[model samples]
Target chain A: MALDKRFIGREYGPFVYTIGAEKLREFTLAIGGAVPGAGTPGEPLPHVSPLLHDAQAAKAGPYGDVIAFPSFAVVFAIRPFSAALSDPEMGIDIQRVVHGEQELEFLDVMRPGDVMTSTGRIADIYEKARMGFVVVTTESRNQHGKVVVTGTWTGVVRG
Target chain B: MPRTFQTGDTFTHVRECDRYRPIYYAGASGDFNPIHIDPEAAKAVGLGGNILQGLCTLGWAVEAVGVFVGDPGRVRRVRVRFSKPVRPEDTITFQGKVTAIQDGRLTAEISATNQRGEDVLKGAVVEASLE
Candidate 1:
């Protein structure tokens, strides 16, 4: 079934997320190929930057604090897209949905303790090649009201 | 010394999706969708088995550019199309080429391919600030 185009422009969130130092380290290591064990996010890999996991180095380096890996914004920025997928009104079959594409723009380095508020809306709903596509565009701003990140999330529903 | 970037400069990064990667990533990223954590649930959904989240692959693409620019915080943008699922034990190689440098920003095109020579991401591009 095709998604109803009427849902276009429907909005989701004001979702708020607070960046934490440990969580930022965990995400950086996990994506950097560190294997986790009980109660540990594993050792940081060589390619993983110290600015992302080491407090002292980061404090001495450029950002003056640990910085979230740019893509780490997805942790909270995904709220709106997730909401739209699970929205009963959209009737999207979760089991048949796959992330089709993603685009993210980081305007500034995200640091621990930064409070980010994100809001997104359904940008488009359409079908092609028998697959239904849902497009969601999001913008996240810091507590200072500065735009920190913008995202375009696309999900494809398999027929 | 600041690094200089030019069009056609290429870099590479490789990562293996270990058996427990999806679970670890789910814990880290808060994406616990069954298709990423439970093999049985993924099979039920006709996915054959659990798959790594597409965002993880995106992260790798960003990492490649971050490494090239010598600072993760300098990365400004990334875009990718998820063309195929990356399963456990799959090793992915990301190759990035500097495609443009203008003002203070550098743009690169990246390709993500699995051990089987299958493309997992298409039309991937990443941009980073040089200053």
Candidate 2:
């Protein structure tokens, strides 16, 4: 894998995309898990919330009209991870991989109607017992580059 | 503390939502956690029966709010915390409630509970409006 201690401190693209609800539903359904009639169009909203302790802080985190989710930060770095692993020089056998862990750190609050831009970098790498830890930390921002959410996705490579 | 939801309020029917077929999902999502697939491995883990991963359960929460948000596009964000575990034979119900409305944003609280009345997961979701 071209991913290791060397890639640390390397920043990746600011790929952006909108989070869709039905896709979320389909994901659950495809996995043989369904929340009854949840995540459907015009269906009653499912119970999910964020406690915005302050209105102004939440407002500042918004990006135009699209409010972003806490996990929404990962979408931004998906492309970067692909590019790095897919690099001709880096032969990452993705088939034998497992999603080790994922963590999100928010610098500011996120609200609905906020369109965000996610930019990220390979933050840290460590060799654990029988596992290689690859960490990518991402920063989500508004059009103005204001920080919204910071996310980290870890892939535990077992070769 | 006691929290209550009224009629028309959406919540995870972890009790009613049952018949989880995770093996098919394991093939689709590329998540083949043996604890989810191999019943024997599950027993090794003290599950006695096949158990589902927390992420698979999170998918339920994401979809439950997706309908109320009016299109996946409206669903702005979802964050979940894994509180407990879900087993294969255990039926899960997603329960939700709209806690706030900020202009075009709808915020709801949701959780996944097993038939035994234990929360397998807990989290909040927020949605944006096309309008």
DockQ of each: 0.89, 0.11
Q: Write one digit per residue (lDDT tens) for candidate 1, span B1-131.
A: 88677899999999999999999899999999999999999999899999999999999999988888889999999999999999999999999999899999999999999999999999999999988
Scored on chain A only, each candidate's TM-score is: 0.98, 0.61
> Model 2, range A1-159, lDDT digits (tens) per residue?
234577777777777655444333334345333333333322223333221122343345334223333333444434565455445554555533344554444454344444677767777877777667677777677655787666556665655
Compute the lDDT for candidate 2. Answer: 0.53
Model 1 local distance difference test score:
0.95
| Error of model 1, residue A46, in angstroms | 0.5
| The candidate that achieves the highest lDDT relative to the unseen native structure | 1
- Candidate 2 chain A — worst ten consecutive residues by lDDT sum? A44-53
User: Which ranges of candidate 2 are over 4 A from the true structure?
Assistant: A1-159, B1-20, B45-49
The residue pairs found clashing in candidate 1 are none
In the range B1-131, model 2's lDDT, one tens digit per residue, is: 22333334664444333345566445434456676778787666565766665555655565566444433334555566555667667777777887776675566777667778787765534443433
Least accurate stretch of 10 residues (summed lDDT) in model 1 chain A?
A36-45
